[model samples]
Target: MGDRFEKLQDRLRDWTKADLPGEIWHSVDLFDQDDYDILVVPSFSVDQQVGEKIEGFLHYEERLLFSLIRLRNPHTRVIYVTALPLCPIVIDYYLQLLPGIPFSHARERLLPISLYDGSLKPLSKKILERPRLVDKIRRALRPNKAYMVCYNCTELERKLSLELDIPLLAASPDLLHWGSKSGSREIFAECNIPFPDGSFTVTSTEELLEELYELWLRQPDLKRIVVKLNEGFSGEGNALLDLRPILDYAPDKCERVETINALDKQLQNLSCQAEGETWESFSKRIPKLGAIVEAFIEGEVKRSPSVQGYIRPTKEVEILSTHDQILGGADGQVYMGCHFPADAAYRLKLQDLGLKVGEALAARGAMERYSVDFITVQHPETNEWDIQAIEINLRKGGTTHPFMTLKLLTNGNFDYDTGLFLSQQDQEKHYIATDNLQKEQYRGLLPNDLMDIIAEKRLHFDSSSRTGSVFHLMGALSEFGKLGLTSIGNSMEEAEEIYERVEAVLDEETKNYGDRASSLPLNWDKA
Candidate 1:
């Protein structure tokens, strides 16, 4: 079955190469004046166990609602599939954001299909399991003018692509290794990029311990180390091991055999980034999913910055945007949100380094979007920043939708020279976005209730000024009290202010609700 699917995928790839012009396939160019059908399968086809840990993970499908803006072209049709039906109010809200398009006209071109299954399986798998659903999708697409886009391409997505007989606008699943934690380290080495000192990929506890011991030997002064699952996402599969607890076993204090023994016992003390995670359960996954250990770059002042770019079908690498990510967890490793264009100090440097990685991935036949994360530390006295490459995400990530929303809303283009996004009106744009605006107080607020708040407070993005708020994950609001939004402004300060205003408004609106739970601290301030 796998071999047959691969052959079909090969044919689909050949079809895409023969029929589509490279320029037309650019992400931003979805609005190009070409007739095509876009099958938006925003499936987070990751390890189910890891994915289940996230609250309302299925609602993430709404992140790609920005794709609806493609309807502004008048010739493009989008068929969005999800695990469950989307709220009509949520769909209407997105359509209303289309600049000059009429609501009814855009609605006519959009098809939102739901499997009505809320199971904890990947949406792609759900579709593959239902032949009727697969046929419905196939019938909705134009014979040769359609392609599928997904959150991440996995074996499931590839199989779905074959079932639908359409090309997937993502990297081939066979090349997914290049996106893994260990594979990312290898790419950094091949490109001569600076990443933390780490061990090769290990698939068993013994192998992991061996690698950790070698890493300690290389960086004896290292205070901490990060253990990452090769296929982790959003840092959930990461754990921090504080070496201070076992300093007595240091190379200087004890013999190699003694140090190894101490390290083995200390492994149980790993502080996992994922909620409710334990070293025992985490280590158990080592054999199923490979893991790696790297010296944790430490500094008094550090920033988590990331660069997003695209690997064009033509093998051209295009840098899309850069952002300073807002992270929050027990040890500040989880992804929370981001400020666009990163910091001026090193935004350009990020672009240069990101292009290097993109070029390398392109050479390896990687396609579509790819993002690289980095840890930048400031020198207290010299004020110089030291940047270290972290890992590569070969998929549409947290920053993808927000940046795409900005482009689709204002028809902006990212100015690589300045690392700023410029609107069609030539005005500069900035935004702060997050998918973690969750609060127990926000639970039970139906889609209509949220829209009423948006209307009363004028929280919607302003078409005239091209600065305001655009919300996503509306489906998660009623059930999980979680929502996502991108607050755009002419400047960084303005963007932050807008986001703060939204936070304040939501707090005020929900403050009177009974049995109120303490609000989770908004981590935007950390950015």
Candidate 2:
């Protein structure tokens, strides 16, 4: 890959806003004073969406940052924004997601995003090669001396930099070093951070079975364990170990008297996957692809968790923590949108430990924004709270990045010392919808055309055009499906009303668009 990129740089001339294949929100706040020393640009999607998956990694943000610094202000100094890291733990957590209460028209009503109708993802044969993209980026920047495009590279970043003559910001400088589950465990031990008790870190399949046997010995009653890969992301890289894999070898793992069929039935209840589902529909799409399984703890406290922290440029832990639910999971869940100061009640419990984790990274000399996850549990006997660290994402999270973009356009003074982003003008936010579009469908829309659609306050399809009048989800019901959404409202009632309206609009649009199959994500402004 590195060799490929190096070869390409000699031929390409990167320019500003060279129309790329995938969706990009190359946005800038019209209201920003243009005063900040370093401006971090948002990146392109990690991979270009192929069929069902967006394969490979490329630092789209790095390409943008390099170009921006040279053109925007090369000598001044800047840091390219990094992409958020996802939990490999939940990647492919469940094969089939059980529909929530309103299962009626929910499937029928969804806007074709989830309906698996042998609709093969028409991924480009030309994947977004990072090295090639970097070559294009170098042509755009023409920088005299390279500084750094900040991010934790995972194959994608390395080639992009080597090809472009750009310095890769080793996230070793940021908490990206803490991306390892083991590193997270250590942060917990060294600082007494609260989190799940991980018994072991198994690397190979044998070690995995040995640990499982040991866990059974230590707590023989424990039946299932949650296994995840150290390098996995989103919900694509994980599995829940049942008796089946070992059933063929060690019948003991499956009770001989109860028989393998009985063991299969039991494991079946753990997931929604049916025996008939296709390979694409299977959970843990790529098995034998490395995993990290731990004791599966069952509990009543199902609410999600988050805690935001920042390591300053000076390398200090001086930031407040904010938290939220991982709102969108298999059940129509996307990452997060809602955020609030860590609840007052849990403050004291998480504060010291949160700081300890932040400081640990700072001591390692990586200073930037990062967030951690944990589940707060009440002791079975004492009813006491124990907030445990799930893992640390070494880069900016979904909540932090978009909000900062809003901050640039708002009237608030962002106190970097204190993680509080003061809402400037009664809060106006961009309702960003990062959805995948069949490139063919989006045949004529331009960046401005999409913005124009948004500006019109129309949330349904234009009957004549056969495209999105506004294809957004019913904010209320969105959370039930995998690609969920929640309206962040000042009042819950208003949020409810918004959700209702979003649904009403969808119903009407569905009736209208069903009559005609329109080209999606049409780059209308393109020539």
Candidate 3:
């Protein structure tokens, strides 16, 4: 098995370095390709505990990316693998949205296979456990050149590629460390990019405490600090501390006892990333996965803008898109959704920083998609924003699906120079997307029911005006009462308006279903 795995790695290298395929290049004319095959594996690819709650619906939400299959030529096949079967109605719903493609033709070319298990384990693990399912996938391969695309690549993904005799079009698992919080900070420094004042790769609470004290000494007026898990996603492994109380005392008066006491108190009261998580549980996790403590960049005029980029196998770095993330939580540290192309005022600056980071990643042999997150603050005196590179996600993140949805649906490209998305028809495009439009009343509502409401209310995307809502997380709605959506329009205001209308429609339709709203705090915009 080890020898076979090594052989598979060699094949993957050859595939990535193979001669050019004009059709595979992502552009407005991607559909013009004559023949090819794309096998999409939308695994959460995170720790099992982090993905536990949403295991059943993770792949279902990725169906949003399947919208790209609609753009493929009839001769080109798309194989979408999932942990469980997708709702046929949901499949039909997306197929009907393709502008000029006939539903039957597209459906015939698209294939969805599942493992028939909805357990809390990672989808890759589930696939590995089901040998019959793996064999089924192996048997479906065509003679044409193919590429395996995943939500993120890890050890399990590498194993799956060997089993299926396919090469992943992503970074090798050996490069996984580059995506961690500690690695991100190192990369930032190596590239000469500006980052926050913090210490990374701290393995214990003691080390973290020492680092905090060091930072406090450097900046006596520090108000807060953030401690993050090296591998946590969507802010679930993040915790914050208030440093104001400790700073209140003079240097001689500030004793270690007093400092530790204050730190303990703040940690116990932190707003953890996971629901129902206590300081006891979170503390245990910190040592196991490692953590980083950094001085929180605070300002009344602060914003979190992220830049998405990709390095092809050939080492060419491409800036994909930028977003102004809408954060939530007590200190606005958790990710919600985002506005596409970021805020026009500083998007170009964000892109420049992103490029520096991307070049560094490419130099290190990183491939496929990665995103650099930043915390930008306005200078009170000059009104100029100073951007601080926060962390790098070497995988698909909250911004990936939304941006891909817009790109595939409209056949558009993000213009890095102008910070705008232009569709194939040369129309300007924008969108507001979120995965947190969740409510208890939304429970027990199946995909079919949601489709009915969309049809009756006429909420489908309007081809004539190029505006409307597209829904995801349908599987979660029936059980978890969670739904995700992207509202696309010609401008930011229009997109936001469309999002508001969609929320209103869902609220009105599902008002009486299930119990009252969950007691858990809303993670997204409640206003």
Candidate 4:
């Protein structure tokens, strides 16, 4: 099956490069075509190092991206495949947001297929394990014009594409390294982009120690360093090493054995990427996963911003959006949310850097979407910002869906010069979004209950006003006390206002219910 999949991918590669009659190419170009088929496989096909239980919860949020179906061309057919079926209520909630399209009209062109499995495995993996589902998908495809859209491309996704004999509108698995931390660093170097001082990729603790010690020798003033996995998602594969204590040790006392032991203890005590993940557990997995040790760039006015871009099939680079990422967690490394258009002061600067890197990626055959994360700080003397490229994500991410939703909802365009999202009416748009709004007290609420609350509070988006709140990840609320929110506004202040109001309303509505009732389990147990 693997060999067959590989062979199919080779043919698809050739298909992508060759012109086909009356066929539109690429996911972004789907709007141009009146007839096409889209197979959306929202799979988190990263290395299996990240535990399955967490992966299952993550899937809850990704289902929101399928809201893309709401923007479907009337002649287009969209089949959304999930590892577990989505709640019917969740499906209706998304469909209701379609502008001029009737709910039934969109539904007629839509297909929701599921494996009915809630394991931590990738959705593509689940689909692969079930030949019946594969055949169903094959039968549903729209012949030669069909393409698979995924959360991320991997060998599993590659194989799945072969099984269906459809081209994947994502970077090939072979090109994924361009999105990894190590790969990002290499690209930064190739493109002459400024990046944090970091050591090359290391596979074992010994190699990590060697890199860190070497970096320390070059810059003894380095106080902290970040150790990251090549494929860490949302900072779960990252750990910060406090180098102060180790650096303070006497030169005479720095025996190789003592140094390694001290560093080992420090690594063990360092933070783990996910909840319940211990250094002991994470450290054991580092050797097999590979890592990079880099000096942690710090400053008083530091901010993390990211630039998202897309490479068209014709090798043109399109700068889609920029974001001021909201980071949380002990070290402020985890992805919490983001503000659109980034900060006006440095938005264009970030865009320039993003294009330089994106053009390099386009030249390298990276297709579809990719984003670059950056760390910027204000210099005390000159008040100028110093920016360092941190990493790149070669797939859809936390920032993807909200921007996509806004664009689809309003048929807007992001202006490169002004750093503003302009709607069809030419009004400036802004939004505040987060995937981490979890409260232990809100555990017992059901999807229906939340929708009722939203209605009663007038929280539904108003097409006329082009402003309101949209909820996602409602499936995780009862069990995980988690829900995703995106509050859109005409200005930054307005967006923040909506987000604050929504939070207050949710708190008030669910206040009593959280303490009194047990959350109702969905059809299946959450991992």
Candidate 5:
């Protein structure tokens, strides 16, 4: 079945190559009034166990709702599939953001299909299991004129693409290794990119221990090491190992067997980044998912910045944007959100390094969106930032939708020279976005309730000014007290102010409902 599936995918890839025009692949305007059908299956398609750990994981499907902006092209139709039906209010919210296009006209070209199954399986797999749903999607799409887009591409996505006879506008499942922790390290080495000292991929507790010991030998002064699952996302699969307790087992101070034994004993003390994660549960996943160990780069002042880029079908690489990510968790490893147009000092440097990585991936046949994360530390003396590559996300990630939303809203383009996004009116645009605006007080606010808040506060994105708030993850609000939003403005300070205002408004509205206040800072500087 696997062999046949691969052959089918290869054939489909060839057909898609011949069907789509080369010029469309390189153009900044993706649809550009072109006649085409877009099949959107926003499936995470990750390890179900890991995915289930996230609160309101299914609602993440709404992240790609930004794709609805493509409907503005007039000649394009979109078919969006989900595990469960989306709220009409949520759909209406997105459609209303379209500039110049009439609401009824855009709705006419849109089709939102739901499987009515809220099971934990990937949405693509659910669709595959239902022959009727598969057929429904196939019948909706125009043969030879449509392509599928997803949150991430896996074997399930490939199978779905084959079943629908539509090409997937993502990297093939076979090349997914490039996105894994070990694969990322290999690419960094091949590209001569600087990364933390790390171990090769390991699949067993014993191998992991040996690698940890070796890493300790190399960096005896290392205070901490990060253990990451090869296939983790959003930093959930990461754990930190404190070396202070095992300092006596150092290479110079102790023998090999003693050091190894001490390290093995300390495994139970690993500080996991994921909520409710334990060393026992984490280590159990090693054999199935593989793991790696790397020295944790430590500094008094550090920033997590990432660069997003795209690999066109023509194999040309384009840097899309750069952002300074806001992280949280025990060790500041979990992704919370981001500020666009990364700090001026290193934004261009990020683009240069990102281009190298993208070119490398494109040379290896990677396509569509990819992002490179980095750890930048400031030098006390020179006050210059030292940058080190971290990992490669070979899919549309947290930064993708917000940047896409900004582009679609303003009809803007990323300025390569300045690393700033320029609107069609030549005004600079900035935004602060997050999928983690969660609060206990926010629960029970239905889509309609949220819409009312938006309307009353004038928080809704203004099509005329092309600045304000754009929200997603509306489905999660009722149950999880969580919502996602992108606050846009003409400058970074204004963007942060907008985000703070939104946070304040939500807090004021929900104040009487919950006991605890949100931990998120009300000011950007404090954050």
Candidate 6:
């Protein structure tokens, strides 16, 4: 139980911060100080270097963690992985919504450039500033190749990688094709699987309305009409186009239907709720970079599974696990959290489908660690299970380390004979990092701040005193914060319990900072 995230994108980005509660790693300072090579990161274009604003992106700190291994052993090589073009349209969306950003001025005239999320930027924008950002990095990291930009292999990525002489990871464009709603539709059709009837693309509302009519004609009992962007994430760029009440468009062409007046009434009703994300605004937010659209399916959220595979040598390993995205609630929030394997009933099926999908993707020139998400539902009439693809995240997903951390911590072995991920008696329990540091400001508190707080909260883990009933597995915190201070414990419950304890410590420190701010020195204005 850690910070819950409202959006999945938020969750992936926040994991880089140091104070993530429940995580075993205490401080990022240790990670920074450690000498290593090959730092994997998100848009090194936005990284901070040894102060001085580090002037142009370098590497996301999380991927930079590998510097730890390299520092310990210089023979190590690091590979940073990047993903698809976010969307080539979201740029205008943000400008329209939050006009304060610098890019707002030129938004109106941003022709020939669509938005793409986090794909660095649209080709046009990148073309404008590429020289400056690239030049800055070239100067800063020139001596011995400080870092490499593992961009997704889109046309831009390919061009950039060639110019920089750095190896790019999964090409965004090709992988993106696998993630399209239409792509998924094709896959479903080939597999003879059932999915919500959907249009390949709907550029205008006219086409949208027409598609709605067609779907209605095909399946009159359908209750939900999901609208999705060509490229999107989490649940963004999606809406339920409720057409039940407003189905009178082109009534003459079909059997008797609701009148035009009813359609107008429905539009009026929609106007009341239309204040949220608009098509025009939502369209631009598509990504100053890359995005895809899809049909939104209705059902309980299920199976946040990822099938991990690596391609330099081409190996496929499907670690099918269920995940709960920790979307820190509204406002500036933290995004990250706990993931475990899927439920018993559907675990096997999920893993199997994931393998099939993963292989299919890898075969189509997208042969790396690709993740495909799906939701399963039962046909109302047949009661048969149906697993529908959600979106394919063809990159290293959140499930990467949680499962690996579990592997590193576990001493037990799995039994292939039993077709189980672990042996029958293999012990599997322990961990805690759900320490919420945001509720309370993380003021000037040092590493020991949390340990002391957990002690006060009576949450310290003592291996010798630990009973299998309370806690059973363990590791020791060698440093504990910043530059690699580690925390170890036995039992997942104990790990979680300790996290809660230290959370209060963060809260306390934040409160102290608040007090200090209010009572500052009166003569402090000399500067």
Weakest lDDT window of 10 consecutive positions for candidate 2? 90-99
Q: Tens digits of per-residue lDDT for model 1 on 152-207?
A: 99989988888888878888888899999989999999999999999878999888
TM-score of 6: 0.57
**Per-residue accuracy of model 2 over 1-527 as CA lDDT, tens digit each:** 64554333322212113354321112111222122223233332222221123212221221222122122211233333333221121111110111121332222221111111122211111112334634444554536333233333444444445545554433432233366666677777777766654444555544554555555445545555555555444433334555444444344455543443443344343331222323233334323333354665556654445676666534556444455444443331223344443444564445556678888877775545566776666677776666767777776544453334233323344343443445444332222322221222333333333334334456432223222222211111211221222232223344345445554543443344435654545764573
Number of colliding residue pairs in model 6: 77
RMSD of 5: 5.7
Per-candidate TM equals: 0.94, 0.57, 0.90, 0.91, 0.94, 0.57
Residues 1-527 of candidate 3 have per-residue lDDT tens digits of 55675555455455545575752444211334545567778887776666653423464435435535434576677788777778888778777877677888888888888777777677878888889888887878774356677877888888998888876777778777889998999999998889988887888877877777777767777888888888887787787776665555423458866766567666777667567766777778777788888888888899999999988766778898999998976567778789997988889988998898888888887877899999989898999889899899888778887787786678777797898999888899999888777777877888978887898888888877778988877766787787778899999999999999888988887776554564335563563
Taking all chains together, the TM-score of candidate 1 against the true structure is 0.94
Cα deviation of 260 in candidate 1 (Å)?
1.7
Model 2, residue 32: distance off in Å is 7.2
Total clashing pairs in model 3: 0
Write one digit per residue (lDDT tens) for candidate 5, span 1-527.
45665554454346436556555554323544556788999998887778877999999999989889889878899999988789999999889878789999999999999889888899988999999878888998887778888999998998888888777788888889999899999999998999999987899999998999999998889989899999887899999999898898887799999999998898899999888899999999999999999999999889999999998766778999999999998899999999999999999999999999999998887888999999999998898999999999999899999998998888888999999999988999999999999999899998987887888888988878888999999999999999999999999999999999999999988888566554445684666
Stretches of candidate 2 off by over 4 Å are: 1-136, 142-151, 162-170, 173-177, 220-223, 242-290, 327-344, 347-352, 378-384, 413-421, 425-453, 458-504, 515-527
Answer with 2 or 3, whichever has the higher TM-score: 3
Residue 426 error, candidate 3, Å: 2.8
Give the range of the ten consecutive residues with the poorest summed lDDT in model 1. Answer: 23-32
Provide the clashing-pair count of each candidate structure: 0, 44, 0, 0, 0, 77
Off by over 4 Å in 4: 1-33, 49-58, 61-67, 250-261, 514-527
Please identify model 1 stretches exceeding 4 Å from their true place.
1-22, 27-30, 514-527
